[model samples]
Target: MTPFTIETNQYLTQETQGFYHTDFGGVNLPNNPNYLYKLKNDPHHNWSDDWIRQSQEQLYRVLLIDLPEVQNHIGKNPLTICVVPRAKADNTYNPNQLLFKAGVRNAIITLGNSFIDGTNYIQRHTNTKTTHLRQPIDGYNNDGSNPYVGITNATCNISNNVVGKDVLLIDDIYTRTVNIDEDAIQALISKGAKSVSFYAIGKTVFNH
Candidate 1:
């Protein structure tokens, strides 16, 4: 996929890309694209708030189509999306919370910790049962003390999520961080995800 392209849906194919036909019938890019595209310039007090509130409903619409895939892999929706927000940001976006009403039939979980006191995106999406893998308190991280707490908690959370079943992890952007995300996936596999694949909504205008 190109850098700007997003994962609209898993089942989509060449015939389906520009085609508009499904159980729901007819899918078009400009006319209800698989997912909404929200740039930083979009409205909102904060970037996290803007993305969570805007992308949830639309994103879930596509995510539900993959329910079979999710069940095949983890057996449910409301599956945890390990959203890693822009660095130096607070409360990264979490898709699980937003996909609840759209048809997520399970609990949601947050991977990384949120700033401003656990400002989780789960609340913004599904009110269904969920959990947060607390980013360990390793002193104020503002001065670049260490960012491992969040990733560490993520590893632990992914490792423990496998209760004799597979799981899915979500994230927003993936590039150089693929290695880092791979690390998280490794941890998830260690915990019990039959497989770990990502549904990246958007790519960076700038990739490090």
Candidate 2:
């Protein structure tokens, strides 16, 4: 499938572009055969190991076939592969949550030096209310600051190594109102990244 752009505004210095492989999450709950949804919701430890492994293989396949074009679009410079931190504190992931991250690591190994593996480049230091469970009025923190900014400031820590590097940020899903991806792109740019591109495994398709 052809990739689609996720960045929709001029919020950054460069016109950053993001692409996703499939559609997920619509008014029709579960959305039949939503592979991305299945990949994310299925845990590596507590769930069916077979399903998770198969899902990860699918992810690796997509990345192997798709990422080359993404690299070409960004020019010949090797792009740093960065994974968006999960919603909770980094320490919470004792055995490493996020099977998606593991898939990314596998893909990077297969791709070799064509991509720089900075998957853990952005680390979360504190926990934030999971975005999906938020109330309508939960857009800001108790301090009245923009929640995205506050969340990034209080929880996120960018590596000094990202300074002056071109980054390709990865996430499992992209939904418009939940601007976590948008905030992350801004965070990377602000941290002296020469540029940043985004890629989501799936983009939420609103069925209203």
Candidate 3:
């Protein structure tokens, strides 16, 4: 299996046991009001200042720039953002085709997956996998294959619908060895997608 490559290791620069830090409230931001636009989060973890900056920076580098190579391979159609297991807090802030709004292009697709999502399937049990590292707001591997519980590609609308759309998917991490994101990509191809790429801010050290 082809392992995911690692780019910047600033996340590894520090001696952090995990990607997140303590919740020190009142953190300063870049003065942009709508900075926190589209994020798939867990209900339990608060959006701490450090968490926001790290995630945003990583997306900027990987999602926006690094994966342009993918576009070269697959003709650009439009961006389709799919969120699996939408955070309870951002319940009303569901996503849309906001690639244009986010200054990308006139093509974008945004959707969310709640508890029974087929997109991203987390497999590890809480204590063993440590994915639920951030309690209450647990993140999982989107690689489940079981028809009932596994990550089902059919669940993502874009999977079978996109014909030649150059895709960029933004999420929090890379967990699975041969996991759900790949499943979603295949699903997109089935949907007629030209290409699909992924980006995430923090990945588990052991996931390497």
- The whole-model C-alpha lDDT of candidate 1 against the native structure comes to 0.33
Q: Please provide, for model 1 over 1-208, each residue's C-alpha lDDT reduced to its tens digit, 9 standing for 90 to 100.
A: 2212222222211111111112211234234333333422222223475555565655554444443344344334434444323332233334433342222222221111210111132121111111111243344233222223224333232224343333344444443323433444445444454444444443333334
Measured over all alpha carbons after superposition, the RMSD of each candidate to the real structure, in angstroms, is: 12.9, 4.8, 11.9
Best by TM-score: 2
* True-vs-predicted CA distance for residue 105, candidate 2, Å: 1.1
Error of 2 at 38 (Å): 5.1
Which 10-residue window of candidate 3 scores lowest in summed lDDT? 15-24
Across 1-208, the per-residue lDDT of candidate 3 in tens digits comes to: 1125423231221111111111212225332222333233324435565665554454444434433444443334344444333222122333431221232221121221211122322112211122323333335442323322223333322433345554454444455442444454444445564554554433434442
lDDT (C-alpha, whole model) for all candidates? 0.33, 0.71, 0.35
Give candidate 1's error at residue 75 in angstroms. Answer: 10
Candidate 3 segments whose C-alpha is farther than 4 A from its true place: 1-43, 47-150, 159-161
Best by lDDT, which number? 2
Compared to the true structure, candidate 1 yields what TM-score? 0.40
User: Each candidate's TM vs. the true structure?
Assistant: 0.40, 0.80, 0.41
lDDT, candidate 2, residue 200? 79
